[model samples]
Target: MPVRFVIGREKPGQVSEVAQLISQTLEQERRQRELLEQHYAQYDADDDETGEYATDEEDEDMGPVLPGGDMAIEVFDLPENDDMFSPSDVDTSKLAHKFKELQIKHAVTEAEIQKLKTKLQAAENEKVRWELEKTQLQQNIEENKERMMKLESYWIEAQTLCHTVNEHLKETQSQYQALEKKYNKAKKLIKDFQQKELDFIKRQEAERKKIEDLEKAHLAEVQGLQARIRDLEAEVFRLMKQNGSQVNNNNNIFERQTSFGEVSRGDPVENLDTKQVSCLDGLSQDFNEAVPETERLDSKALKTRAQLSVKNKRQRPSRTRLYDSISSTDGEDSLERKGSLEKEFKQGQEAERERSY
Candidate 1:
């Protein structure tokens, strides 16, 4: 009878180095078993009319060769004829012994394979754990880099702000210095101008006082001259009465008139006082006349009386008013005042002539 056996072929995931080695060994054992079965079948077909049996030497030669040496064969089956013996029985015995040794080796290999499988599963689990740790570490590194980028941007902005502030401070300092210099210059200029104005005011006050004194002296001189003229006129009248001559009397009167004219023309001070008094009278009269036209009789009368009091008793500052304002005069206007004063004098003379007429 022929025999066949099934061989196991595991899936790719379940296969390993040890499993492949076991498969190859099983394949070799199956081929050897098939060869032994073929020899047994051929030996059974041969016709030996004499009941012959295999000798010890042939049994030894027919036995399968093993790695160590030739082993003794076992008797497992009883021969069909008790007296008949065959060489196939010896091959069967040797194969059965090999099968027992292979079974024992297969059991030891299965236990070692089970231990190896357990170790492989642990190594795979450890590899998976290491991969997870690597992924987490990468995420941490990326997040740290992002944070560093944000921090670097902040540092750059801070540096810019610091630079701007420094520039602004420098500019402000320069501006403050310039403004301070200007302020100091202006202050100095104002102080000098004030001193000059004060000096000018002092000079004006001295001139005004001097004019007042001169006016008083001229008034007393005019009074004395008037007395002297009265005495001379009295003496002339007595002489004319004594002579009783028309021509001589006319000569004396002509001489007196000529002397008065010479005195009035030569004394410019007297003419100035006369014109000044007349100008004040004209101003008072004009104001009185205009007041009546513009106001009620009672208001006009009061205003007129007040003006008359001022004109009669107070010293006037008409000459002072004639001076150009110091504040308005740029030295050029002050220089032009002389020509203007001459024209004003001419106008005053014309007005005085009209008054005499």
Candidate 2:
């Protein structure tokens, strides 16, 4: 029979060496046994196969018949039986002991082979497990690399976004700074304008006050002049009344004489005409009045004309009423402008803060 065995590549070198030695020794022993059997068969085939028999006998001779002379002669032949040439008991016993020893050695060798086979199988199983574990580790490594790459990409993107946000913030800061500069300039201009406006208002107020004072002085002067004219007019009126009464008395006397005694009519008429002409000329020269030809024009018209001249000198409105409204309106407008400016300033401050952020 052929000998077959299995071994694992992962098996230890020492074990394989030991098993190889055992297998070589067993094969050599088997070859020796086969050679021995072939030699015995050839010897058996070469032996003679005669089926003849042989008997053993003894012979006596007559030579010993003389005196003590009768001597015995004996002849013996070997037996040719198969039982006589068979192996003895000692040889059979020795062969049986050797066969038992070979059987025990074969049993020990079989046990070693079985142990080696079991060890080899265990080693194969371990190798397969190691290979599987290695494959799993490799796959894990690939997955980890992919994850690391993804994390790196995410980090890069975040950095880029941060950079963009920083740039935007810088731009906003620049814009806010520019706007703040404009606001400051505007504020300065507004302050200057407000100062100018205040100065203008103050100057206008002073001018208005001066105008009012001048108007008051003029009115006072006009009133004083009016009082003096009234006094002069009264004096002139008293003189005119006195002169008229005297003229009337003279006429009455003359008229009584004409009634008592009739004198020459032409001479009295000429004297009366001369006296009337002199009285009219004296009245006109003293009073500075024009003589009215008609009696219908002689009432209060002449006196009213002198009084109207004084009153008409003050033709404009009173200073207080006119200037008070203007001053009040100016004050209100200035207050409103100040409020609007303050509001704009506050808005500018808030915008500056927002830009700073």
Candidate 3:
């Protein structure tokens, strides 16, 4: 890509170089044309000067004469010496010969002028071609400059975009690094948490097993003690029954002794007629009676603890209803917030559209 751009850029420079070359060639052509024009002008001026000299020579060839055309009268106006001739006797032959020479020189100069004119015309034509080339070169230069400006602008914009992309990539890389660190830390924490959870579960299982064993042993001991108590209660009832039978036999013996004493008192009544007086006198003074009364008063207080076992046979729905009501309220509030946000977003979009328009 850089090579392409360099190539593209070099094209404009090449165009500029060509323009410079064309300009230089045009300048050289112009200089040559000017020199040719100057040389042509000088040749034309020399031709004009030579023509003026020939015209003067022609005027001289037409010598001054008398009003009446008489060559003899014109020669008589001489001084005594012929060598010191009069104006009329001035030499016309040499003047005529010089005029012919001036005519020949003028013809040669005119021919040179004509040749110079031809060369000047050719130079002018070359100059015209060079001018056309110069104009085209100027156009090419302008076009190249415009293209160069466009390419430079494009390069600058591309560089800016590349810089922005690089910056964004750097930021993304930094964010990735940060996220990687966070992920590693989170992973370590998760591993530690899992290990601790495993240890906790193991400890809980061990404790549960220990408690179950203790419960089983305690239950067995309680059952054994209950059986022993029942046996002791049966032995106590048997000893009470044996003691009751012995008490009944002793009561019967006491009753017999009382009856025998009553029979002995009846026989003594017949033999005692004679001694009736005496007995009556003794009995009158010896009447003895004894009565024993026993009374017992007892007060007792007893404290007993009675336990009543009550169980709930059914679950209540009211507790579930309370939870449902709370959750429904939360859900409704969340929906309302969502609606509000959506409305706000729509309003913002509409406002943005209005601003854009």
Predicted model with the maximum TM-score? 2
- Best candidate, lDDT-wise? 2
Candidate lDDT (C-alpha), each: 0.53, 0.55, 0.50
Q: Candidate 3, residues 1-357: lDDT per residue as tens digits?
A: 111111224454355443454465456546655765797588669866863222434434533631232211211122466553333533443334335534644554465556645654565576677779999999999999999999999999999999999999999999999999999999999999999999988976785565446444544543453354345334433433442343344335434645576536556544433343453334223211111121321111001000101122333535433444454355456446545644653464345334322
Model 2 CA lDDT for position 263: 59
* Stretch of 10 with least lDDT, candidate 3: 300-309
| RMSD of every prediction | 25.5, 33.8, 37.5
Q: Tell me each candidate's TM-score.
A: 0.31, 0.35, 0.32
lDDT of 1 by residue, 1-357 (tens): 443333456676787444554566577656655765685556545423432344456645744632243232221222378332243443443344445656755664465455545644564575577679889999999999999999999999999999999999999999999999999999999999999989978975675565456544544544454454345445544543443353345346546765687545676655646755675466435433432222211233234334544755854535422231232242234325434643554575456444433
Quote the RMSD, in angstroms, for model 3: 37.5
Cα lDDT tens digits for candidate 2, 1-357: 333344346445455444454565567667755765686466445533532111112112322421242222211122466463344522443344445545655665465446545644564576577679889999999999999999999999999999999999999999999999999999999999999999988976786566557555544544454454455546655764676576567567667777887656667666655666576556556545421121221223224433443555844545553554354355456446545644653464345334322
What's the best-to-worst order under TM-score? 2, 3, 1
